[model samples]
Target: MSQAKVDNYKKSKANRQKIMKREKIMHRLEMVCIALVCVVFVGWIGYSVYAKIDRAQGTAQETVEFDASAVQNYVSGLTQD
Candidate 1:
């Protein structure tokens, strides 16, 4: 049992650098993926809010009243001529 443990320890020691390098690469990749997901989520939320506000403003503009009396008078004058 002791001999097996020693053999395992030596093998691990020999491959330690490779294992550590792989772990470092994996950690960086994980952080990048997390940051990408957060950016996408925030962008989606911002767009939705912008779209909602734009829609509200559009409706408000559509409901506004404008004076057409000048246009009506112009047309009436043209017809009389």
Candidate 2:
């Protein structure tokens, strides 16, 4: 082959190698991003469930402290037709 053709072939081969490296780096970056997103999503779900449980316990405690007479009065009001 002519020298010019050989040089062209070498340049093309080098470009292909560079492109492959870039693609590999991009694939790794994508994987890291996906993992980060998954971790954050799971953390949010856990926090939401924890907050709901905490709020429910607090509300239960508050509601459990009503006076007996007040409960009787309220029950009587509800029973009236």
Candidate 3:
């Protein structure tokens, strides 16, 4: 082969290799981004569930200390509005 043709072939091969490296790097970055998103999604779900459970556990029922009939009479008067 001529010197010019040999040089052209080498240049083409080098360009192909460069493109492959760039693509590989992009693929790795894409995987990392996907992993980060998945982690955030899971953490949000976990926090939501934890907050729901915490709220349910924190609220406790209490016994009423006043007379119900007296309260009912006051409520009836307020309902006149």
Worst 10 residues of 3 by lDDT: 58-67
State the lDDT at 5 in candidate 3: 100
Candidates in order, TM-scores: namely 0.73, 0.59, 0.59
Better lDDT candidate (1, 2): 1
Q: Which candidate is the best by TM-score?
A: 1
| TM-score, prediction 1 | 0.73
Worst 10 residues of 1 by lDDT: 57-66
- As for TM-score, the candidate ahead, 1 or 3, is 1
Q: What is candidate 3's lDDT per residue for 1-81, written digit by digit as tens?
A: 999999999998979988899999999999999999999999999999999998997786567787799889999999997
Best model per lDDT: 1
lDDT for residue 20 in candidate 2, whole number 0-100: 93
lDDT of 2 by residue, 1-81 (tens): 999999999998979988899999999999999999999999999999999999999877744455699889889999994
lDDT of 3 at 44: 100
Cα deviation in Å at residue 74, candidate 3? 49
Q: For model 1, what is the error of residue 4's alpha carbon versus the real structure, in angstroms, after optimal superposition?
A: 1.4
lDDT of 1: 0.97
Ranking by lDDT: 1, 3, 2
Clashing pairs in 3: none
Which residue ranges in model 2 land beyond 4 Å of their true spot?
A: 1-11, 62-81
Query: What does candidate 2 score on TM?
Result: 0.59
Q: Which scores greater on TM-score, model 1 or model 2?
A: 1
